[model samples]
Target: MLRLHRLFAVFLLLAAALAAPAHAGKPYQYYAVGDPTDVVLPQPKKTSLVLMGGGPDVDAAFAWLIQKGGGGNFVVIRSRGTDAYNPYIYAMGGARSVETLVIPSREAANDPFVIERIRNAEELFIAGGDQSDYINFWQGTPVQAAIQELAGRRIPIGGTSAGLALMGRFGFAALNGSITSEAALADPFDKRMTLERGFLLLPELGSVITDAHFDTRDRLGRLVAFIARIVNDGWAGMARGIGVDVETALLVEDGKGTRVGAGSVTFLQSVGLPQVCQPKQPLTYLNLQGQRMSGGGSFDLRNWAGYGGATLPFTVSAEAGVLLTR
Candidate 1:
């Protein structure tokens, strides 16, 4: 009886191990190009790229992108899991014109037609929602691969709020609650958090991550937390934290550079800092990398190293307003 019990336990352990790989970090293969900093523009035969803001104006952004195409066909995907309120359809003008592919659940993110649409899309847009839903549902699935393929083809991929969060090479999963100014100032490190790796297909934007509703939401503390995580993990020696204000968008052109729109984009760079972190303390012993030019200031992705001298010490309440306004 004892031997039989032990055998059962061993079998259970093996079964558990086998189950783990299904959810493990399976490697994603991508097409390679020379120069990590180089941005690849989509061929003219491909699709046009347009990343829009998530707000009352989201539809306007979409319409603008579609009109910009001069009658080219396009497809839009709504990643928001709930059908309660669809900005793409009702709020946005997408109600009658474009067919909105609504993935109301995480499981729907794997639909073959959805993935195929993304792969062949002239324009792909991720609608706003809780970004954590995106990380949990789409990360490492065929949907993610299709987005990567569209990006590689240089097609415009855009999102708002949660959707906007997915724009960066490294996107905050937002598994933790929304990082508000109060929470961020109180504690940079929040619980229920995990980072999504390799969601965006651009290498130039690697080591540079983004957050939305920056100043309005007081996301400085959260952005600081994100930077600290990157440094602590040694994933990249230096990283830039880009906080985009609500109603604002940053159009990244083939990774060659970024164009600011609507609100403003804040770039936070962390200079020299010890890799070690004490438990429960705002990441200390670090230098602030300094802010990027407010608005209309552009930097070559290849020459990002030139902006390294501007690190600032991480602060919970640093006041840097939007540099550009529409």
Candidate 2:
């Protein structure tokens, strides 16, 4: 009886190991939540994007993403997270398979297997993690090239929090750690406000910077500061910023954006240039043309205007370290 009990214990351990996520840290790691075999389901794929704020997940936005993917293979890429997204995404039912790849280094990001999975994915998601990791590991590598290729094919792409930060043409890399709205407004050129361009080319999002957890984190001042710095850096004549509220997402299809969840999405642009945007000084931007949108109606990303009555327009400015509005 003792030998039989020991044998049962070993069987249970083997079962637990097999049930765990596959692949562990040789170079990279991956966990499959649904069907293990690769599959290409015959469904009409559509090109779309989701920028989710950091907080609770938005169910409607995810359902829309799955619908856009056309019930095909879904691949999620991240640098610091585990396979937590796999089972969550797989159970959503539009994807035939859900795979999560935890790529922590440049070598892992450039792995041929990793690149191939991204290239073939019908829908790809970037999980919330440190944006700097994504930049350092994936930038200039075959992984980046593969993602650009997938974008060229117009497949669905989505990200939340740090993931959403990089969807715009201009991304806040967050290399030096996070900077609060107070810190950013106090000094527009704060060293922690590291923004990068050409990392990922989404022409539709040209000259745009995205901020997540907008309402909950009070990130409006930071977003405004980011735009001020963009014009200060001469990247573009005009800079645009998108701030998504917590527990909400901005779904971009074609050139229009549809807000999802309970919170609002704020869009802002520099009036022209900051009056006093020098280093070690507070930003003094005269006017920031802005619009706030709720869960209804479509906001045009092309003209940066709203169609229905669900939009509210406001103007904001910063003087010294304080943000003011009229």
Candidate number of the best TM-score: 2
- Cα deviation of 254, candidate 2, in Å: 0.8
- State each model's CA lDDT, in order: 0.55, 0.85
TM-scores of the candidates in the order shown = 0.68, 0.94
State the lDDT of candidate 1 residue by residue for 1-326, as single tens digits. Answer: 99999999999999987544221331211111112122223344433344444454443456555443322335455554332332343334322223345554556677665565456555556767787777777777887778788667655566777777777667788686665544443344556346666677554566777787775666666676677667666777877777767666655554433434566556677665433343454444344554543355454454552233322223332223111111
| Location of the lowest summed lDDT over 10 successive residues in candidate 1 | 28-37
After superposing candidate 1 on the true structure, give the runs of residues whose Cα lies further than 4 Å from its correct spot: 1-42, 45-53, 58-64, 67-71, 81-97, 185-188, 256-261, 274-276, 292-297, 305-326
Per-residue lDDT, model 1, residue 28, is: 19
